[model samples]
Every structure is written in structure tokens, then in C-alpha cells.
Target: MAALSIGIAGAGLLGRLLAWRLAREGHRISVFDPALGSEPTFDGQQAAGYTAAGMLSPLAERDNSSAEVAALGWRSIALWRDVVAALQARPHFAAIGSLLLAHRGDASAAQRVLARLAAEASGTPRAQALSAAQLGALEPALQGAAHAWLLPGEGQIDCVATMQALHDEARGVRWHWQRTVAQVRPGELVFDGAPSQRFDLVFDVRGAGGRPALPVRGVRGELVWLQAPGHGLTRPVRLLHPRHRVYLVPRPGDVLLLGASEIESEDRSPVSLKSAVELMSAAHSVLPALAEARILRLDVNLRPALPDNEPRTEVAPGLVRINGLFRHGWLLAPALLEDALQACALTQPAEPLVAA
Candidate 1:
């Protein structure tokens, strides 16, 4: 097969991943983003990737996602392991699994989660019910939780570090940074206040920026990063609640990411006081150490979602659009990239998988 020239619009997580994948296949790739080239201070204009909890929890996500997504997410974990191994420098990541806990009052919620996990339509979404003793043995720091479940083989990634690794490893691709893409057409992109450039294929993974063109909505998520110093949890922990499903995913150097509040609004404002209080109160309730953790930063981002909250890949003549990753960016990216490659005729069946 001939190497095709692919034009990618959007330099967020999807764009960077797609860029590196194609470039490794010896294809000519050009990435155009409005924030990359000109930003000196790393102001995240197209940066939803930077704010995610980076949880690669396929089983944990089955309740809120379609079976197809669950399947894709399960596959992505292996792909990510390979991709990270091939990175210029590996990012801070862990596959320690996760603990899904619920207080005695929320035991019903925990049971509902268990029921949903049993009913998951795809993937080997398995979990073991945990007694308080087992839970304490798993996470000795946790307390006051009567019911819990241990999800094995799950993991978390520091997306901020992974994005940088992807960017650094994406060698030999043309970058058009700080250049706004007005319209993505078949075989070409219409730039804002500039001449249109043509390519053999176009990839639109612009997240919420692809807005009215794609039927995508922005769901607001706020995450709080804490400097835990000497008191950080060993692995990611999920606390089940009536209104919020909170996760505290740890990064390297004693940093704990406490998140997140899922609201149905696209308001791009700072974290609300009400949300901070609610998240803090819930996390502190589960992990008492968080009460004394140093406040690092509060971040708010709008995740792109379709009506079903599943990511979509559209194939057309000389064009492919991938979006609606909705809180599953890391979980679903590798499969989505493969979909894009197949859509663009870059690879076919019987091709050997790319190994690190």
C-alpha cells in the first residue's frame, strides 16, 4: 500500500496519538491545532486531555458506557502498554487495579454497581465482593466502608505526562500550531483567515471544538489535584455515592487527583465552591488523610459526549471524524485510532500488529 498523506485537525490527546501512530507507519502526517505552536505558558485551549483522571478502568466504566465501549476500553489497555513502552520516555503510570467502595449507607449503590457489572454486555468485566476485612487488607488507609468490590487488572495513567510523551515521540510530522481550523472538508482543511490546504485524507478529532458540525455535547468535569506529601494512597479508589462517583487516582511523587463532579452544563468556569466542598467532604469521609493534604490545584474541563456517551468514528470519502470520548479518552483511544487507520485504508486484515 502507498503511504498516504493524512491531515489531522486538533492536537489534543486524540490528535497527538493519531499523529504518532500514523507517523510510525511511514505515512506523511500533518497536525494542525490552534494552541500548540504559539502558546508559551501551556494555556490549554484544546486541552481536555490534560484534565482527565486517566483511569483505564474498563470494568469500572461498564455501567455508564455501552458494551462496545467496554470492549474497546479493554483492548486499549494492552495497546497503551505497548504504546508507552515505545514512547521516547515512559510516563508515570500504574496498573495496580482499583477499589470500588461504598459506605454502609450506600451499600445499595454498591449492590447496584455489582449487578450492573454482572450484566455488562462486553469484555471480561469481573470483580470480587470484598468484606470489610478484605477491603482493609487491600487499602489499610480506608475505613467506614461496609461493602466494596475489588476490580483487578485495571489501571491509571497520568495523562498530562502521557500527552507529553506522545508529543515527543511523534517525530517527522508537520505541525501547524496556533492555526485555527475553520472547516474540515474531504481531502482538505479550511483555515481561519488563511488559504486552504489539501491532503489525501483528513482526521477531525477536535472534541467540543468540532461542535455544531458533529452532534457532540460538552459535559463539565471538575478535578482537584492535591499534594498529599507523605500520605497518598497506593492505588485508585472509587467511592460510590447517590450523586457523585468520586475517584482518587494517585500519580508519581505523592500527588493525588481527587475528582470529579459530572454536571450537564458546558460552563467553562473555575471549580465551583459547592462542587469543591462536596468533593472534599466525600473524599475526606473515605480517606481521612486527604483532610490534611495540601491543596494543589482545582481544574475544570468539558468532556465531549454523544447522546449515548460513547465515542464515535465516522468514515467518509477522504475524511474520518473521531470524537465523543466522554471521560474515556485514554480508555478508548487505541481502538479509535485503529478504526481511523482502517477507515483511511492505511492497513488491512492480516497485517502484523505493530510491536514495540
Candidate 2:
């Protein structure tokens, strides 16, 4: 395959991942994102990954996602590791599996989640039903969780570190940080107030920034970080609730990534008090120790999603537009990238996101 000059317009998770992948293929690559910066501020926030719990859970998402999505996630576990290994950068990856917790009153919620995951098994992984004793054995820190389901093989990643590692590894790629791309066309990219450039291929991955051109709607998501070392668990936990679902991703340095609230609107404001209180209360219910955790900060961002809440890819003569990842950015990125590569005839033949 011949290397081509490729210009990527975005600095989000997908943008950064694709940049290094293309660069490693020996292509001339340049990337731009408005929120690109050296550090994610003292508040520990970035435009994309900082607020995400980064759960790479395929089976756990079986309820609302298409079979294609579940398959894509099933593939991303290996693809993510391969992508990271190809760059030789260390990112936090915990494949110890994930937990689905439901209180005594929510036995139906836990059963429903388990049943849905079981039915999606068209070669996808399965989640094991767990008794209270089993759950306690796995995560000793969790309390007040009577019934649970252990989604085997699910995991998480530190999105911030992955991006940083990619940045350090992709030394040859040109980075145009803090630049907003106004227009993108095949072989052409027009910056907001800079000279336009031509390339062999142009990638429009601006997330919500390219909404004018791409068919993407912004879905706001918010997460709360806490300084809770002793409250940390071994893996990600998804607690089922009647109103909203809560996920807690434990990170190094005794920090807990508690998220998030999903809303239909595109509002970027701080979390509403109702949602914040609900989230905290839910967390406390799952792990009583969380009551003592110090409040760190509230993080909010909108995920680009289509009406179907599924990711998509569009390819033209010299342009490729990928978006609508929504909340599955981490779980589906590799498969979507494979689609992008297949579209460009840059990848060897492989199975579809889900075999027919």
C-alpha cells in the first residue's frame, strides 16, 4: 500500500487514535482539535476522555445496542491492546471484568440486564450471574449490593493517558492543536482563519464541531470524580437504577471516576442538582464507603450521536467522515477504524461488525 498525506480534523479520542494508526502506516498525518492542550488543567479535565469512565464493555451493553455494536466492542478489546502495543505506550487497561449491581429491591433490574446480555450471544462474550456471596468475594469493598452480574472479559482504559502516550509515540505526525476546522472536503481542509491545505485524503472527525456537515446530535453526559482511595474497587462497576444507571471506574492514586448522567439535550452546563444528588446517592448505595469520599469535581461533555445512537462512517473520493460514536467511543473505536481502513482499501479483509 502507498502512503498518502492525510489530514484529520479533531483531537478527540477517535481523532487521536486514528492519527497514530495512520502515522504508523507510514502516511503523512496532521491533526487539529480546538481543545488540544499540554495538560488537562488542575481540575483534571479534558474535552473528551477525562469525563469518560472508558468502560470497554461489550456484553454489558447488549440491552440497547445493535448486534453490530456488541460485536464491535467484542473486537475492540484486542484491537485496543494492539493499537497500544503498536505505539509501545503504556495506558491503564484493566480486563478484570465489570460488575452489574442491583439492590434487593432491583432484582428485576439485575435479571433483565443478565437476560439481555445472554440473548445477544451471537458469538459475543457472556456475563455470569453472581450471588451476593460471589459478588462480595470479587469486590470486597462493595456493600449493600445483594444481587449482581459479572460481565466477564469487560474492562476499562484511562483515556487521558492513552492520548498522551499516543502523542508521545507519534513523533512524526504533525499536530495542529487549538485550531478549529471550519470546512472539510475531499483533499481539502479549511481552518477557521488560516490557509487551506490539500491532501490525498481528508478525515472529518470533529465530533460535534462538524455537526453542520455530519449528521450528529450532541448528547450531554456528566461525571463526578472523587478522591476515594480506600473506596476503590478492583474493576468497573455498573449499578442499575430505576431512573438512571451509574458507573464507577477506579483509577490509580485512590481516585474514583463516578459517572454519569445521560440527558437528551445538548446543554454544557454543570450537572443539575437533582442529577448530582441522585448520582451520589446511587454511588453511596452501592459502596457505603463512598460516603466518606471527598468531592473532587464535576465534569460534563456532550457525546456525538445519531438518532439510532450508533456510530457511522462515510467515505467519498477523498474524504471520510466518522461520527455518531455517542457513548460507545471506547468500545467501538477499533471496529469503526477497521471500517475506515476497509473503506480506503487500507486493511486486509475481515469479518463484518457482526456476521450475517
lDDT scores of the candidates, listed in order: 0.83, 0.81
Residues 67-181 of candidate 2: C-alpha lDDT, one tens digit per residue: 8898888888888876665655568887889998888898877777777788885565577778778888899889887777788889898887887787777759888878888
TM-scores for all predictions: 0.94, 0.93
lDDT of 1 by residue, 1-356 (tens): 67888899998889999998888788899999888452222222446888888999888998688778888887788778777877758897677789898888888778888888888664474888878888878888887777778888888887988887777778798888888788999999988789999999999989988876698998999889898777647888898977787988988897998989999998878899988888888988888887689988888888999887888888999999999999898899987787677766786634444562
Q: What are the C-alpha RMSDs, in order, of all predicted structures?
A: 2.0, 3.7
Candidate 2 wrongly placed segments (more than 4 Å): 36-38, 41-46, 348-356
Position 184, candidate 2: lDDT: 91
Q: After superposition, which runs of candidate 1 have C-alpha atoms over 4 Å from their true positions?
A: 36-44, 121-123, 348-356
Candidate 1 weakest ten by summed lDDT: 36-45
Q: Candidate 2: global Cα-lDDT? A: 0.81
Q: Mind sharing the TM-score for model 2?
A: 0.93
Candidate 2: how many backbone clashes?
0
Error of 1 at 241 (Å): 1.6
